[model samples]
Target: MKAILKQHEEHKRELEQLNDHWENSARYLEYTKQELEERLYHAEESAILIKEELDEISIQKEIEIQRLKDEIKDLRQEISFLSSSQVNNHRVKELEDALNKAMREQMEFKEKLRIAKEQSEGGNGEVTEVTTTVRVIVKVRPFLDSDPAGPQCLMCNDTEVQIESKKVGSAKCFMFEKVIGPDDSIDELFMDLESNIVHAANGGNSCILAYGQTGSGKTYTMNGVISRSLNKLKQRFDCESVMISLQIIEIYNEQVKNLLTNDPLSRDWKDILNLSEIQLGNNWVSKAQDLIKKSCHKRQTKSTDSN
Candidate 1:
C-alpha cells in the first residue's frame, strides 16, 4: 500500500510539470505576437508622418509657383499701361500729320514754280528790251578721265566746260550732278581738303557732306572724309592747340543714341549748340548750324588762356 501511494504522488508531480511547460510556451507565444503587432503599428505611424511631411512640401511648392505667376502677370499689365500712355502716342501722331501737310504744300509750290517759269519765258505785252547773251567757249581737262572712271553725261559731252576756279575753298560750295570715284576713297572726293583747310580756318566754316541710299555708301563717304580731314588737321597743327574731339551719335528707332558712351539716352543736341554760341557771343541762325560748329571746334582749337 505504501509503494502504491508513492507512485501516485510521482505521477501527479509529472502531470503538473507538463501543464506548467505548456502554459509557459503559450505565454511566450502571446508575448511575441503582441510585440509584432506593436512594431507594425509603429511602422504605420512612421509612414503616415513621412506622407504628411511630403504633402506639406508639395503645398509650399504649389504656393510659390502661384505667387510667381501672379507677379509675372502684374508686370506685363504695367508694361502695357505705360506703353499706352501719352508721350509715345501723341507725339507720333503729331509728326505724321505735320509731314503729310508739308508734302501737300511742297507739291503746290512746285506747280506754282512751273507756272511762273512758263509765264516768264512766254512773250508778254511789254516794252521790248533786248539783253545780249555772250557765248564764250573754253576747254578744260578734268583731273580724272571718263574711260578710267565713268562715261560723261550726254548733255555736257558736247559743251567745253571751263574751270571757273582751280583753288576750291573749303566753305565754297559747288554742285555736281554726280561724283565719280572709287567706292570707299575719300581722297578722290575731297582731294583739295588739305589745301582748303587753311582757307577754312581763316574765316569760313567747312561743310563736307554726302547724301545717298543706305547701302550706296553715304555713311562710308562721310566717315572717311571726316576722319581724313581731322587726321590731316592734327598732323598740320599742334594737337594741344587744334585738337578735334569726336562725338558720334545715331538716330535709331526714332531716338538718339550716343555711340561714344554706353548710355542709350536722348540728349538735347541743342544744348551743345547753345553752350557754344554763348561762349562765342554769337546768335545762331539755326540750332543745327551751331551744333555743327560746336562739333568742329569742340576738340579745343585754342586755349582759353594763352601765355
Candidate 2:
C-alpha cells in the first residue's frame, strides 16, 4: 500500500506539470492568433490603398495615352497642310515661268514678222515694176471744206490699189508706178515732170497737155511746173546764144486775138496754127515774167484761151 501511494503521488505531480505546459501552450497560441489577426488587418488596409493607387495610375495612363493620340493627330494635320502648301508653291512658280516664256516667244515672233514684212514690201515693189509698160499712177486730193465725203471706197497701198472697176461684178487690184497721197508736196510733182520738160528743151519733141474736170488743179500744176522749169533753165543755161522765144494767142468766142500785143498778128488763122514758121528764137523769153502775168490776167477777164 505505501509503494502504490508513492507511485500515485508521482503520477499526480507529472500530470500537474503536463497541465501547466498545456496552459502555457494555449496562452502562446492565443497571443499568436491575435498577432496574426492584427497583421491580416494591416495587410487588408495596405491592399485597399494599393488598389486605389493602381486605379489612379491606370486612369492617368489612359489620359496620357489619349493626350498623345491627340497630339499625333494634330501633328498629322499640320504635316498635311505643309505638304499641300509646298506643292502649291511649286506649281505657282512653274506657271509664272511658263507665262514669262510665252511672252518672250510672242515678242520674238512679232519682231520676225516685222522684219519679214519690210523685206516682202521691198521685193514686191521691184517685181511689180517689171510687169507692165503702161504704169498707172494716182494722186489723192485733200478734202475741201465745201466737199462732201463718200464712203470709204478707195483702198490703196504705196504702189497698188484695189478699186472697183467701172463695170459691175469685177474686182481687180491695179498696181501703179506711184501713188501720191494728199500729203505729198507740190514740189514732188514738179520734180517728176521737170525731167521730161528738160529732155524736150534739149531737142526732143515733147508736148505736155493737162486736161481734167473744171478747176481740177491742172492749170495750177502746169503753171507751177512752167515757173519752176524756167528758173532751172535760167540757172543751167548761159543766155548769150541760147535764144528762147514765145508766142501767145487768144480766141474769144471764135474771134482770134493776139496775147502778145507788143507784136502784130497776121490775119490768117492758118498761119498762126502752123508750127513750121514758129521760132523759140527771139520773142517772149526776154519779157517772160511780165508777159506771163499779163496773159494770165487777161485770160481771167475774157474767154480768150484756146489752147
Task: Point to the candidate with the largest lDDT.
Answer: 2
Residue 155 C-alpha lDDT in model 1:
18
Q: Compared with the true structure, what per-residue lDDT tens digits does model 1 show for residues 219-306?
A: 4455556656655555556545532433445554445555433444355655433332222122212323345444433222233331
TM-score of each model, paired residue for residue: 0.30, 0.42
lDDT for 249 (candidate 1): 54
Cα misplacement distance, residue 245 of candidate 2 (Å): 1.0
- Whole-model lDDT, candidate 2? 0.56
| Predicted candidate 2 versus true structure: per-residue lDDT over 1-307, tens digit per residue | 9999999999999999999999999999999999999999999898667656655654555455344334533443454465667766665565555544543443344334333333434332111112233334565554443544432445665577665645554667777567644434455555445556566567655454554555446667667767876776676577556777665576655555566554344456676655323344443344575676676665533232322
Query: lDDT of candidate 1?
Result: 0.45
Error of 2 at 118 (Å): 22
Residue 284 CA error for candidate 2 (Å)?
6.9
297 in model 1: Cα distance from truth in Å? Answer: 24
Task: List per-candidate RMSD values in Å.
Answer: 34.7, 50.5
Worst 10 residues of 2 by lDDT: 124-133
Report the error of model 2 at residue 20, Å.
Answer: 99
